[model samples]
Target: MKKVSKVFYITVVLVILAVAFGAAFPDQFEEITGNIKTFVATNFGWYYMLLMSAMVIFSIIIALSPYGKIRLGKDHERPDFSTATWIAMLFSAGMGIGLVFYGAAEPLFHYAVDAPTSEEGTGAAFKEGLSYAYFHWGLHVWAMYAITALALAFFQFRKEEPGLISATLKPLFGNKMNGPLGVLIDVLAVFATVFGVATSLGFGAVQINGGLNHLFGIEIGFTAQFMIILVVTILFLASAWSGLSKGIKYLSNTNMVLAVILLIVVLIVGPTLLILNMFTETFGLYLQHILEMSFRTAPLEGDNRSWLDGWTIFYWAWWISWAPFVGMFIARVSRGRTIREFITGVLIIPTLFVSVWFAAFGTTAGDVQNSGIDLTQYKTELVLFNMFDNLPLSLILSIIAILLIASFFITSADSATFVLGMQSTNGSLTPPNNVKVAWGVAQSAVALILLYVGGLTAIQNTIIIAALPFSFVMILMVIALFKALSKEVKSGK
Candidate 1:
């Protein structure tokens, strides 16, 4: 039964891939993606936001309630990792590359072109810009992670049904959610994660290459992507083989350190004053315009800026698609944490950290652009190089950039591989280490294929396609979560 189900899922994914690749020409891809963006914004925009908001609120309630206990098992054992370390590792694993890639640039770009929620005028424009990033990185995004993670931890550790999304939904559908429905959910998550992280991989690879090129004066080419993937595969496979006790724990710890160093460097080098000021204002603007902004799916009108349509709308979809993987990772790491704690850790902490990074790095990038640096002439591979070109001690900065990009990529890839393995193995919540290694290698191969084929577009399209079904599953997941919570409370778990 499982074999048949897996084959059916694979067939469906292939059909979807064919459709995406069939539109590989630049114009065709844009047109199709554009139409998708419009459809999402027009019809499903509010639904997505509302869904995210409810998850966030429930997470907050869980954290505050004494009921949502993080346990190693149903019996409640010792702490796995320190709270601080666990939170850092979780954040690094959860959002890693995308957070870095999108943080500063997203808000700044929104400010320049205006998001859907923005009113006319510079003041409103800046407010709208900052708000978009906040929403993308804010409570809603974390809530998605919280719900998935909490569901997994509760179901797998507590109920012991193999720890997949299908297993999590078993509460609602009883046995029916098994078989095909269960397989469908798991497959959908795999596809979403592949595409989602592939985009991150593409972006990180390009940036990592640019950093290396700038540092060593090497010509930019496919060599960097190849090397980056090679390094990622090696590091993750080693960790996966070593098991979570030795591998994931150590990798997560090291990755956290590298992230801290990068943040400190950005703070020291970038415009401290501007970032501080902008962060305060941006946070305020985000808070002030939170509701209006959350549902504002930039309408496809004659008056809309193509740039806004390209960046903001695309980002929203991208984040939504990536939510499952990121959320699942966060949930995995958040054992023993209350719902409130999980939500706060996933939502608040990361947002604060990302806001700082964006403010510092984004302000610097904006300054470079404003100073007539003209980064637009460069391809994506030159993005980091272009940014560091104007900063002090270009060589040292380039080195730091390379290290940062590498670590982020490695950590994220490893985490995703682990999560994918867990999702697929159909065993315990924390699957056997060998299963983790298997998925990690599969992810690397997928990353290689994506880079080899159509670069970032193919990867991003794949993730989006994966999300289509999962998003609906998520809607059902949300309903199932409430039902489970109610049952627990009534029975007093």
Candidate 2:
């Protein structure tokens, strides 16, 4: 079994290296991209979207149900963190630089192009925009996280399954995973995690570079990427080596506090009234037209299909890819908690925060644009920087902005590193210091490579392209989750 798992891991690494490096140094990256485009278009296309929608609804029902009351893991002992701290951890680890990266741009992009829901008169685009962000970021994504987390937490902590995606898949594959099947699951999970973390690292480097440029008027190059990666890696490794109590816990708390401060500032300093209105209306629109929006293909009439492919499908795939890491992390933190509580806290609260965040940041940008502010000259990463630039007290606000961006990036890197470690370590259940540090360094390296290859666009394109295989895996996971739950309930376990 060990030999099989090792082979699987080594093979996956080789294949991924071949593909990533092949594309990186290829005669044609476009050809590789074209193949990826074809796969997403044909395979996941509409079925993938519909399946994800079903999974979201089903997971939410489970989250809200009474039978979902079972706590995962054998320990049944509560962790040291309070409810508030746990919430903070969830938000910090799952969100990371997303809020910093998309807060301003997503809402405006939705307003300008309009969400799929907005095509009809029933759902206004702006309102649906926030809802869509919430939906993608919200319960469903967390449900994916929970599926693996719950499995790991319960099995490793309690039932003593190894702390790996393969262990979770064991209930289905049985001892087969002890053979070749186990290797397959773990290998897929590791590759997915590496690329996912790399994507985050790549984006973080670009965003950090952009923030520096905005503040100091410096040109970004290898020097900038290397410096950012080095700093981020060191911070995360230091935190990891310090142990969860000192490092992860401290960083997560800082991240949540800084995040709340940024949100409050945006609410108070930006067009507060407009953001509020957009939030209320947009949420209603999302609720009303969710079914249509979730399944909308926008076939052939326009490249509406392509747009869905780019955003909704792409986001779903990305989330799916990250599930192994995020799920394991959630599992570690969640013990002695009922399934219902875990789901609500993990899935519901974070999603709500994402909605408000998009509304607050994105809608502000839209309002400014609508009122004839030409902030378009600023790139997406720099959108928030530009908005903060307009503040009456620019210097103080800029400093705050820098802190906010740093907090987002560090928290994200830290969490991803921890997760990758947990997954790799055969499910130690609780995070070990060495595992965390190794993942942190690995993630930073990927970020450096992506930066050396190109910029943010290249990273984003890579994530989308890499998402193809994982999309299928995610669909299987959804099915497996439902089956496992049903079996457990029926057996009265």
Candidate 3:
């Protein structure tokens, strides 16, 4: 068997053992994972904040530096897809269902509870809520993705290396990257990718179930979530089988159009002026307070520290956990772009789009609540639908929202399956169909098992714990990338 196959089998066995154990001992699994998650968040919350800050700084510095001129591929080469297609794919693969999941809910949560810096339900809290929402989903998260994707693209396209995380770190260990150490790194990458994507899949399942429940009066439970996952698993695997250009790209474009329509409709039908003012004001606040918010930790907040850990720290860890999958997918699609173009596009375009999305949905939800609708009483998964209740064509818009979610879900899972196939198969650009199918099933199985074990809480804990080691790994990748870049510069390549 190939080394990739050996790694694949070993990973499969390990995941199976974990799932079996979790299924057999659900309460114990949640307790143990929950405790570990708390310990890490409590002790290392500062570390996550500092690390994210550094990544954001690094991404900007590199983009503005002389290295900005460097192309990810040969100088004469250009991008494979159109700019529009590329951005759509980037948004779809990176944060699809997540944006939909939190667009309204996150801001409302912050407004209802208020941050350490603001008072609840007041204008101050409202502005702070929108600012925090942008902060969580802003440049910091994409900077993480930019750094990882830059490293992978640099090594793969510039040096003609395999597109694997371990492969990108060849400067650190040299030949050892081809030995047992390399295998171990690849295994860890696979582990992180599976869990991170599974977490998203879990979130998508729950939200999809919630949408159905809101629309058709279906009961919300594990069975419905599992069924949703099963249907989506089939859709995404079929898309994966159809390959990247045909299935993934088409769905990404379609979803992007759908998302834009939804955003425009909400802005027109909802409080247009309030959302516009909220976005303009909150965006300015985000710019002015970016540094302070980026580094804000539980240590500084005194009594309000728990909120920082539960929301900000958790988001940081979740974004880092997703770095491997999103970064790899970005690199795969961004082969022929310059470093400046890649970093600027990834960091700017999507962040701005998310800001607008949050402004439309989040501020609108806040407006509805202030008008006495009280959307906060609903479950987080159903908050978006509940907000839709007060809008024009509620049922039609709800169905459109459901379709958008499903498309995003399919695109995300399809991209994940493709990336996981490459990671497990020695970075083959076109991995075998069987490998893709196996990984698709494995990802769903993990999501289902975690759903049964402890639902969203368990899923969040799993991602936080999985991200810790990979955070260290990403730091090394940054080092290795710079080391290699220095050599290339000296050699005048």
Candidate 4:
């Protein structure tokens, strides 16, 4: 009989038990998760802000340092994929569904609340809304991803270590990285990745269900959302089985094309001049306030502190939770690229795309609201479809948007399953089929349970709570990576 790896079975069993317990005791689970989430946000919100700012600054410094010239792989090796395909896969894995989910809703929500430093529904409010959207989806999150991916790539390729998160820290912990500590690190990573991806899957299903409800008048409820998860889980499991080169790459490229088409249609059909102006002004505002916004915590805003916890702090935690899956996937595809190239692509390209995406959908939605469209009655998940209702070919565009969401969901899940398999199977670059299938099922099961428990609030709380520990792990990874890089430079690599 083939000997099964202990990490694989241990992680699987632990996750299964946790999900089963949560499902069986839904109220208790929610209470616990909610309390933990609040505690972390209230106490550690400043830590998250400072850590994210440091990550952003660290990534830039590394990219500009002399070590930037070092290739992720061997000295003479070239990139595995072309630039366009690489960027597509990066964006697809990093924040595809999130961009679609928040592009319209977040800006409108910010506008309604009169988000910090602006009055409600005014021109400044619109710009502030887009600026906050940009801040949430901008370079800082990408910097978190880039730093993790860089560490994984450098250790796995340059130093010939296994592609495990703990392996990147061998410089600090030495042989202990191969023992219980390493197993613990990998297990926490598995937990974070599974929950993070499941939360995303749940969010995507909700929006897809909302789109369907708007298009065909289907009732929006748990039944419909579960069905969406079931279908997407099957689709992505098959994609995971097809492996990365065929399934993930193809879906990512297709998603990029569809997203671009939707973007162009919206820009042409909606208020073009308004979107252009908003993009220009918001881009400028984002640049001007990037540093300020990066460190903003509501120390003096009384009850408004909850706003920071919900939006900005929640986003940072969400991104950190997602870093394991996204970072591993990016590392898997990023062999042979230089550190500078990887950081630049991961940080700049996707941030630019997100800015354009937000400017298009966000500004259009803001315009609709300003023109007396009452969007307050709709759920946040349904906001995009509601925005579409006011545009040309509403039905057709809604369907197209639904398809885009589905495609993004599959791509994200597909990559996540592959990464989970790798993390569980001792960092195999190509994890086995059965392992992939197992992760696929596990992810869907968790999403289904969270959906049944408390819908979006449960999912958000789960992500925030789950990401707290992993954020500290990421800080350790940065230190380990820097230590390793210094040695590499001294050795004249």
- After TM-score superposition, the amount by which residue 336's alpha carbon in candidate 3 deviates from its true location, in angstroms, is 0.9
In terms of lDDT, the poorest run of 10 residues in model 3 is 1-10
Clash pairs, candidate 3, are none
Error of model 2, residue 72, in angstroms: 1.6
List candidate 2 segments past 4 Å from native. 1-31, 64-66, 74-76, 113-125, 430-435, 476-487, 490-493
Per-prediction TM-score to the true structure, in the order listed: 0.86, 0.90, 0.98, 0.98
lDDT of 3 by residue, 67-163 (tens): 8889999988899999999999999998999998999999998887556577788888888998888999999999999999999999998888988
lDDT of 2 by residue, 1-493 (tens): 1212263346346545744774477434545655675576556667657766776776677876654766664334666568988888877777677677878876666666645545621236656667777666766677667665666665666566777777666656678867667766776776777667677767667777878898898677779778877887787677677666567778788877887878888888888998898888877766777777777776766655666766777777667667776776777777677778787788678877888888888777776776667566678778777877664555665667667667667767777766666655555545566556656766676666656655664555566666656656655655555666677678776
Q: Compose the digit string of candidate 4's lDDT tens values, residues 10-123.
A: 878977987898889989888888999999999999999999999999999999998899999999888999999999998899998888888899998888754666677778
Best by lDDT: 4
Model 4, residue 345: C-alpha shift (Å): 0.9
lDDT of 1: 0.65
| Candidate 2 overall lDDT versus native | 0.68
The runs of at least 3 residues in candidate 1 whose Cα sits more than 4 Å from the true structure, single-residue gaps closed, are: 1-46, 61-75, 112-128, 300-309, 429-434
Cα error, residue 52 of model 1, in Å, equals 3.0
Candidate 4: RMSD to truth: 1.3
RMSD of 3: 1.3
Each prediction's RMSD over C-alphas, in Å, is 3.8, 3.2, 1.3, 1.3
Comparison by lDDT, 1 against 3, better one: 3
lDDT of every predicted structure (CA atoms) = 0.65, 0.68, 0.90, 0.91
For candidate 2, the C-alpha RMSD (Å) to the true structure equals 3.2
